[model samples]
Target: MTDFETLGAFYLGKRYDMPSRARRDDYVLYDAKDLTTHAVIIGMTGSGKTGLGVGLLEEALIDKVPVIAVDPKGDLGNLALRFPALGASDFRPWVDPQQATNAGMTADQFAAQQADLWKNGLAGWGQDGARIQRYHDAADITIYTPGSTAGRPLSLLKAFDAPPAAVRDDAEALQERVNATTTSLLALLGIDADPISSREHILVANLLHHAWREGRSLDLAGLIGGIQSPPFTTVGVMPLDTVFPPKDRMTLAMQLNNLLAAPGFQTWMQGEPLDTATLLYDPNGKPRGSVISIAHLNDAERMFFMTLLLSDILAWVRTQPGTGSLRAILYIDELFGYMPPVTNPPSKVLLLTLLKQARAFGLGVVLATQNPVDLDYRGLSNTGTWFIGRLQTERDKMRVMEGLEGVSGGQPFDKGAMEQTIAGLGKRVFLLHSVHEPAPITFETRWTLSYLAGPMTREQIRSVTALAPAPAPTAALASAPALSTAATGGGFASLDARAAVAPVLPPDVPQYFLPPTRDGALLYNPVVLGLADVSFANAKLGVTEQRRVILMSSVDDGPIALEWDAAERVELEPSALEQRPHDGAAFGALPPVATKARNY
Candidate 1:
């Protein structure tokens, strides 16, 4: 067994360790105590934050700690393959190791051998059942729309009605921290959990009171039924007009329709919340660990929806103390979405409470963002440890420098071997800092490529994420006679039933992988690049699910502005407006992924 019980140094060039590239003395190790602190990892695009993060997770999992990951890009799916690759009986025969390690291997041998790491023993999901199941279980769905008047849904706690499982001892305080979460959520939704003016409170309180009166042993479905109320009488009863500004609700309606079409989601959410081990449904058998993929999500609505689910999970984990004997870790790949004070911030105040207190409750928050500027400073101040990566801006650098000292109590720490902005910008090396480690060190991230290559191309996405074109609703099912949704005594399922959607890509639906065919073709797709989950508003899936619109280039344009309809499609583009004066000032370079098509 490994000597350290918690996080420590990575295998570091130990796999590729060589005096030829740099001296072994240059290596820095991560501190175990930092596991108790908050960590912030920053780096410019492509600076290897993924590699570093995979390394940390691999170590933690090996030590038997369960981790929950928010993999916006699905990059961390490979953490399950960290089984000491170069040992005497392993696959190191392919990896060339200078004259010393190369005696037994070749480059081709290495390439072919590494591919096997992608298997999960089943089929596509890597790492057999252990890693894949962990992710599948943690995956969930959430959907929120901009200017949406629907208000937040009933929280799991309110839906269930049972008082928190009593804390057994002071040592159990960390696990029992769920007691304080309702307040945190209240702060996030800007609703008064107090049952006063927030309007949703009475309903919420009623939902909770119902859970208590109904009985504590009931499952989630029973709880969903207990609080089920008529849509008009429920908070949903508020007139659509009073909730949204105008026709924006139409867009919200359309977006929900899209999610209703995806079969993976249909099969995923069909019955129980516990069957799938999902982030939202949890339908699968509950595994002790999970990883949610948010790569497909790219819009504000989806991003925020995902944030809500994560916050909800933090609350859910509180209810189950013995789900497993090991400590649980929540490693958010790109923490900005959850922690950022951006245009639409989730309950930052409530999230902060979790950040500061959850560690004690067995929830470790790992915030990794390339842009530190977006993180809500008030909440971030709660973090105790930080993984400082290669930052682009001097302001970011300074804020990090100062924040480190403050969090560490001016404890005379080193910013690692590559602390100063200098030559040691290796992909693996990062300026690591923590409250317990006397000095920060420049450490390399673990190389997890044998397992990380997951996202298929656009064609793959279209087929994988797409459904088999759901069959048309029969007269009865279409009327949802069971819901009698419009019926006077309609059930809550009927209320949600009326709003169900069927995905049908319109003629104008754009392709995400297309590029500008003609030069000077500018397509501005309002994309939300995150290291977190993006979800359908009122739908399922988080983490790797993204909300984004791929708008093509405008042939005719003055100075143009972009507007997103509620459905998250590009409702307004430069060409859609009359030409204004054109004075090319300056703009940032576009991400390489954008493709454009000419309009006739």
Candidate 2:
């Protein structure tokens, strides 16, 4: 027989008899591909929920799958507690001394006992130190703490970046993203503004829509400026001033500006930006298990960060090729508040979008929660797999059953029978319900390779991730690839402060100045700009196409200057160019070689 623990098959555990309370010999191998349709884990406290979720992630990582887990409670950081030696010393630092005292043993003795218990638990589940090592070597686990430097900080600086062409081209997706972003931003400012009623919400939404539609990115500064002086003069046929006067607009701007100028707000702008590809893979292209711990963030911050992340993931998903096999997993540890039933939060919109569309692109979403009452079951009606663990109350069981029935999609479901099975479920026992399978089965979760040290402190988190790679500079990621200027000392030459006029170019070499978007004075620099209309025609293939491209390259007096090969392709129109610079704008001195038409 094929080994149940082989790649692509997650070895959850052996089957269990509920009525007889007997564990079966047959191992339950869950196919990783089944996750393409997504899954959910619903269990109450003390029901072994975290263990099962962590086990699933471990299996996925061992199979070379990348995971981006959002951990609100901080328990998932225990993924970093892998100790290949399985020694007492490895468990000493993390042992609970109170538990040791209760058990009538010294801390060292208790640690030794814990080590032995882990060894025996692994043996009982047919796992050993070798398998643990395999799990450790499979993927590098990193804990990321947003808005805090406890772990690797995750920056929201690039969160407002324009979506890729895929998302921008789809009107519904574009509007959905805009709505989520705007709502989340307002929420961070402690405004519970509704998209339909609140002028604040509508104006901010329109500002974002206008900028993003033009493929322009905005930081907090730019957004605040836009709020003060909107690009458009009207709001849905009404005059802008009448809708929101300049005084009111300035008030709104000040609020946002105060947030931007806050003492600790800079932390939100530091560290790595939210890039889905980087989060899913390491620099060497290996799969990674990235755990984003949000336990330190407030409710508003969590909603805002999650909304941005989901929006980015949605954009990333649209750029990926469609596939039936699972490409990656997005696991949200607690989904209660993010996706409530009656009220729609910014996170909910993106979550629903992902659940409906991400499956086609091989992105599986796993949502887990201990609170069943707050979930939006109607939104999760299509979830393909569910791991139902021991419930706390009859009400919780009823809510889960209703969700399960909705997921059944007209298939026969025996609520009473399932309830009995759930009632018979003991700790660590779960009912695995999957649409791909004919019927639900009961199974016990296998031993976890990593030690469950509970919610880790900031100090513990830092210790665990001390060896992980340092985060790359955000500037390096934001900037486009450019030629090395090492020979020129990697910086611009000293400028002529006396020069106040724009450099005159040959008639054949057209020059157009860019209009400034901000209120500050502008500075002009000479560059070699070219526009071309290229065409490709093939008679046999019956293909004919024409495209407009604009290339811009800096002019320098260096030996390898004016290289069109190193020019950046700019998405701009010739009409937007100005024939003259704005009044009072400063001019940067042109290089001596920039005036030559031959250089172009």
Top model number, TM-score: 2
| Candidate 2: count of backbone clashes, pairs at least 3 residues apart or interchain | 0
- Expressed as tens digits, the lDDT of each residue in 34-69 for candidate 1 is 564456677766777887776566555544445566
Per residue, candidate 2 scores C-alpha lDDT tens digits across 1-600 of 346678799998989998789998889999999999999998999999999999999999999899999999999998878888999999998888898999999999999999999999999988899988998999999999988888998887678888998888888889999999999999999999898888999999998889889998766766765776577999999998899877677778777877876768778977888899999998789899999999988999999999999999999999999999999999999997899989999999899989999999999999999999899999888689999998999899889999999999899999899888988888889999999999999999999999998998898888877868776556546663422111111134344442323444433455567765555545565666789999999999999999999887877789977888888887777788775555434456677787676776
| Candidate 1, superposed: residue stretches over 4 Å from native | 1-21, 25-33, 80-268, 271-289, 298-308, 316-326, 342-344, 412-424, 454-600
For candidate 1, the 10 contiguous residues with the lowest summed lDDT are 578-587
Error of 2 at 286 (Å): 0.5
Q: Report, for every candidate in turn, its global Cα lDDT versus the true structure.
A: 0.41, 0.85
Write down the RMSD of candidate 2 (Cα, Å).
13.3
TM-score of 1: 0.49
